[model samples]
Structure formats: structure tokens, C-alpha cells
Target: MSTINTLGPHTPRIALIGECMIELQQRADGSLQQSFGGDTLNAAVYLARELGEGGAVDYVTALGDDSFSDAMCQGWADENIGLGMVQRLPGRLPGLYCIQTDAAGERRFLYWRNEAAVRDCFTTPAAAPILAALPDYDILYFSGITLAVLGAQGREKLLATLIEARQRDARIVFDNNYRPRLWASVEDARVAYRSVLPYVDLALLTVDDEQALFGFADCAAVFAAYEQVGTPEVVLKRGAEACLIRCGGESFEVPAQQVERVVDTTAAGDSFSAAYLASRLKGGSPAEAAEAGHRLASRVIQVPGALIPK
Candidate 1:
């Protein structure tokens, strides 16, 4: 219910917290194309593109002092994402993941990320300043993947920051991108998700992920649960189906755009969430925003990777 309009004419400063990994995409010829991608990072890039000069998007995470990390920082900068809050740790490296796409464009992933530098992001001594500065942003965005990667201690610190950020009137946005392999158990993921739900102002939820994580019987059940949590705005994304939105005590459904050929399904949801949030930030209604989300996602699924060309 809280609108960016309340903040007057000032451009919103958005900070997205999570990890960006070194990405390897296996090609049809059996070669590999190396790039960078992650859930929140992909959202950050697309959000920046969607918002353009309408807002400021910053990425908050820790990376290594290595060349890959350096290239990642430069790439984010080229995308117009702020790097002021990024931390670089010596002798540490970022995570890596490989994407294998079938002929149908559905993706399967292989990860090597247990010891990534971002796991210690909020636990590091240098992180104190970044954590302290996080509460000042106009919007603070993160995802369930952030919860899984941060572990218990880092999540505690992040929760404390979210509490303070909410108190300072920063709108909290959450994307429920539940990854089973990232958490120790399903119960652990549920607890972490429930802990953050109360603080979220706008929730960008994937219906399939919600069902997998909470065993919700259907979309109605998913919306009912978020209603109980008092989330002001909720968008339920169902791939290839209509996206349902509940906001301001009303509901709306926007049909997903049809795509003839699907090259890769990577970043489809991330791109959708970014476009939806960008539209809302720019004063579009829920219906308009969902349309924007669908349009972007349709294009994204036709691409080969997480980020499409500007």
C-alpha cells in the first residue's frame, strides 16, 4: 500500500543484496561460454535497464580480489549498477555455476558455491559499514536465495538490518526464489522465509517455488498465506500462465505473453520481477506492471542466458 509517490519527486535508491556467481553455459557444440549471473544480480541488471534514469540501482555483495571479481564489478558498473557497497575479500573467491539447457530451453544447474566469499558477506569486519549503510536506501530488495546463501549468522545480521530499514520507512521487496539444494532442509527454508515475510512490503513470488517450499495446494492458498502475513502487495508468477496480483485489497490477473520459440528459460522470472518492480517504482498500476513483467519475461525466455542485450 506504500507507494513510491509518497517519497515525492526524488528518485528512489534501490539496493539489492545477494551473490553473483561466475557462470558457465554449455553450448550445443559441447563448448562453454563463461559469464556472470545470479538471481538478485540478474534482477539488478534488468531492473537497472528497466528503470534507466528513473531510479538508481545498487548491488550489495562480497566478492574476491581476483580477476573474475574485478570483471564482475566492471560489468556491473557498465550496466549502471552502483558498486559502492560491494566488498572485496583477499584470498576468497566468488561462487561458480554451470547451466545446461535442454532443447526445450528448460535449464538445469550445477553449483560450486559452498565457500563463496558472499557466504561471509555480513559476517566480515568490513561488512559493518555496508550493513550500517543499507538502512538508508529507499528500497531494499533481496530473495530467498539470499537467505540460503547467508547461513544462520549472516541471516541474523540481515534480519536486524531489515528491521531497522523498515523502521526508517524503506520499502522491503522479496522474491521467493526457493532453491532446495541451498538449504539444509525444507523446514529450514520455510522458517527463514516466514521470518522475512512480515517485513516485506512487496513480494514477488513464483507460484511453483511457493508450492515446492510450503506445499501450498494452489494459487489461492498461496495468496491466502501472504494475506495472513499482511504483505501489502503480492504478485504470483506462474510460468506460461496468467500472473495473479493482489494489492490494496483487490486482485488482478495478467496473461503471460506467448513466445513461439524458447531458446533458454534462464532468468525468465528474474527479468519479470525486475520489470514489475521498475514499473511500480515509476508509478504504474499493478495491471500495467504485470504486463511489463510478462513482456520482458517473454523476451528473456527467447534468449540463451540470464542477461539479454540492452
Candidate 2:
């Protein structure tokens, strides 16, 4: 929208905050395929791939000192994602989830994460320094799941860090990846989302999720809400339809790339958000960024997991 680089001239430093669960995808043959994925972590990996050597992408979350955790870290490292902000707590474990996909590629998830190590990501004794360091990055990326997982105290710390980060001129990017089961109630979810809206520089929203969370009637209502909050940029992603964007007081739409077939819909939005941010940080216009998002997302849905092969 600005036409100039969205993150200034330097290569941006980005930190994505959320959990990365041990993902188990149930196959048609009744076996489970294992991997690691979560909203922000999927975005982090895709962002790292999209940015390549042009920028830095780091993942900030607490993990357990276990074999699965070690494997998750190694996988991220292979994707060129930085783990400097990751903490390993003893005797704890990462969350686990099973993905079941329908014939049309839509996915449903069953989670077991009540005791995940990342639940204390921002409240542990070792978290003060991490919170203090968050403001130094060029951009902070997170999602609604990040808010949900980080209990009340942890969310407060994150909000404080976001405020401080904004004061220091860092951009805050948010994805409204809403899952009703993650919150105690719809009202509670609404409260948490409202608390962070005013601080966001860019918001990547899926129409269905917004509608489910805030009860917005349509895309128009969704945009109106973000406009009222004065968010600088907002992108509304509609599955198989054009993604509408509002930036700098103007709106634009970009159609999604048509895919011949979809194997799994996991991480579709995550890949899109990552590519959109990557394009913007590299000086592309909002429309161009949306096109980039659509391109990457089209490819992701053809794969069986949250991450396609590099």
C-alpha cells in the first residue's frame, strides 16, 4: 500500500510466537503419519523458506527436553528457522494433535495439549529475558492460538511486550486463526482478540474464522471492524475465492490460484501469511503480496501435511 518497503530498507528480523505441536495425520489406511506443526510455527517455516537469505525468521516457544522436541528443533533448523528464543523445560512435553481430512481436503483436528510446555512460554522464570528481547526485532508475528495457549498471566506479559515493541517502532503482525475449542468460551475469545487489535500493524484474517469468532455477517463487516480499529493493513482470506485487502484506506482483491486437486488443507493460511509478509518486507505492493500468498497457498493444499517439501 505504501509502495515503499513495508519494513524499511534493512533485512527484517521477525519472531513468530506460538506452539508447535507433534502432529499426527491419520491416513486412509488407518496408520498415523508424524510431523510437527502449529499455526505460527507453520508460518515461521514457510516464512523462512520464502525469505531465504533475504531476512531472518525466528520461532519463540517453550519446548520439552525430549526426543520429539529435539526432532522438532532439528526440523526447524533444516528449514532455516532460528531457535535462539526457544526454551526447553525439563519433564515437560509439546502438545499433540491428530489431523483427519475429508475427501474434499478439509481437515479436522483432535488435540491433547493441556499440559504442553509452551503453555508457560511467557510465564516461566526464564521468560523475562525473552520478553525483554522481543521488542528488538523488526516484526513480531503471532496468532489467536498464541493468545489462547498463553494463559492469562502469559497473555498479559505478551500484551505488555507488544506495547513495548510498538513503542520501539517494531511492527506487529497478527493472524486471526481462531479455534473455538482453544478458549473457554466465545466471549473470552472475543475479549482476548479485542485486547490485541489496536496494537496490530497487519492482520491476516480468514473470513470463516472471523465470522465464527466475532459473528461478522460477511467480508464487509469484517473489514469494517478492522477499519474501526485503525489497523494499517488487513487481508481477508476466503477459501477458493479472492482475498480482499484493506490497506492505507483503500481496498483491493486478489484471486486465489486455482488448484487442480487438493490433498490436504492444513497450513493453507499459514503459507499464505508467510509469503504475503515476505513479499511486503521485500517491497511488493499489497496486491502483489496477496498474489504471492495465493501462489504459495495453492501449492501447500496439494500436499499431505502442514508443510510441503522444500
Candidate 3:
């Protein structure tokens, strides 16, 4: 029963922890479109757009003191996303990737990110101060991609921070965005994911990714896995179909809005995760949040890239 306009204040502060990379897209006619994108960064931008001035959204990542990094920071500031915690390492550069779409508009990405500056984000000497400030936020948002990028030692530090943050009453929101290529093997991702599950309050899962990563037979299996990890809210997104929600000991089905044309499916899940979290921060129920998710994702896929123009 929640209308988008009826949503209340979003004063809660959320720190989105991840990387943003330079994005280049190949058009059907062999032209190229340049932009910036990353899973959690997309979520941060969409979350800010949905909340407007209602909430405090900070993007936590490390960038180099290069022109591309400078441009990226300026763009985030233009979107009203906080960059105070972003570290600028000397002589390093941001990551880059290219997107190519099939005839069906389905997308594949080629990354040049193995040497991205963000890989050392949490392990750098400057990271001590940044990690100290994270627990002050009302919510902490991250994804599997964030984990993969942080590497093992950095992830250990992050896991400790997540535990401390939750102990201080901050809610943890996680998205299961499994990019297999980012990790050495599926077992590595499984270990990283398991280490963080017990502290998660809300988990946004993509059914296809879960099936590919964890071999979850269905939504039921996904729900069961999270429940065992003590996650109270679980939202499942199945592309083009209804999303499933399990919260407060009850489950609900929220259908996605039908789009006339699907230009590109990139960032569909990222946008949905943002809207859903924004709805929750505004005090909407899980069912209502799922509806908000679908509303935003429906609008996103109709556009050509991971980020749609505001």
C-alpha cells in the first residue's frame, strides 16, 4: 500500500562500500559511448536519486589522484553523493571496462581492472582512518563484487568492521552480485560470502546469480540459506518476472512492471537493490520495498546503459 510519493523521510545515513570504474560501451553501429559504472556505485547513485535530499548517502572507495579519478569524484559530488571517505592514492588510476551487447540487448563486460587502484583500498596505510569512520553510519551497503576486489586480507579487515558496525546497531545490507571472473574460484567466493552472512540484516539476491554461484535450486533454497545465516529480510529478483520477498515470517510476490522495450539489461539489479533499500530506510514494508525496486528497475533497463540519465 505504499505509493512512491507517500514515502516518508530518509534521514538514515548509508555508506556504500565499493568501486566505480570507467565504462565504455560499444554501439550496434560500432560506435562507442563512454561513462562510469560499478555494481555498488550504481546502487549509490540510484539510491541518492530515489531519496533526493531525504538521506545521507556516502560512497566509500579508494581512487587514484589521476584525471579519471578526479572526474569520477566530481560526478559523484554532482549527484550529491558524499566523497569525504574516498582515499586518493598517489600515482594510481581508476579501473576501466567495456560493455558489449548482443542482438538481444543482453550484455557482456570486458574488464581491464586487475590493476585497479581500488584493490588496495582497504589495505593501504590511509585505510585505517577510513575504516574507523564506517561504524558511525546508520547503514552499510556492499556486494559480492566488493568482497572479490578486496582480496582475502582486506576482506578480513572488512569482516571485522561489519561485525563492529552491527554491534553498534548499524544495519548491514548486502547484494549477492556474483561475478565469477572476479574470484579465483567459486569456492573462494563461497568462503567470503559465508564469512559475512551472519552480520547481514537485508540480503538482495538475484536468482540467476545464486543458481550459478551456490547452486540454489529455487527461491526456497535461497531463502533457507539466508534464514540459516539469520538474515531477517530476503528479497529475490528474477529478471522480467515477479520478485519474491520473505520478511516478518511471511512471503509475498511482487510482479515487475512491463517495459515496452528492453534496450539494455545492465544495472537492472543494481537499480532494484537501491530502490528497495531506499524504501526500507523510509519505513516501508518488505513487500512495498520490492514494488519500489521493480518500478525503478523497469525504468532502468529501457535505457541503454548501466546508469540512466537523471
The prediction achieving the highest lDDT against the true structure is 1
Residue-by-residue lDDT tens digits, candidate 3, 112-190: 9988888998999899988999998888899999999988988999999998988777888899999999999999999
Q: Which pairs in model 1 have colliding backbones?
A: none
Instruction: Compose the digit string of candidate 1's lDDT tens values, residues 1-310.
Output: 4753355578999999999999999999999999999999999999999999999999999999999999999999999999999999999999999999998999999999999999999999999999999999999999999999999999999999999999999999999999999999999999999998999999999999999999999999999999999999999999999999999899889999999999999999999999999998888999999999999999999988899989
Candidate 2, 182: how far from true, in Å?
A: 0.7
- Model 1 has an lDDT value of 0.94
What clash count does candidate 2 reach?
0
Give per-residue lDDT, candidate 3, residue 133: 91
Q: TM-score of every model?
A: 0.98, 0.98, 0.96
- lDDT computed for candidate 2: 0.93
Question: What TM-score would you give candidate 2 relative to the actual structure?
Answer: 0.98
- Order by TM-score, highest first: 1, 2, 3
Lowest lDDT sum, 10 consecutive residues, model 1, at 1-10
lDDT of model 2 at residue 55? 93
**Model 3 pairs whose backbones collide:** none
Better of 2 and 3 by TM-score: 2
The alpha-carbon deviation from the true structure for residue 308 of candidate 3, after best TM-score superposition, in angstroms, is: 1.1
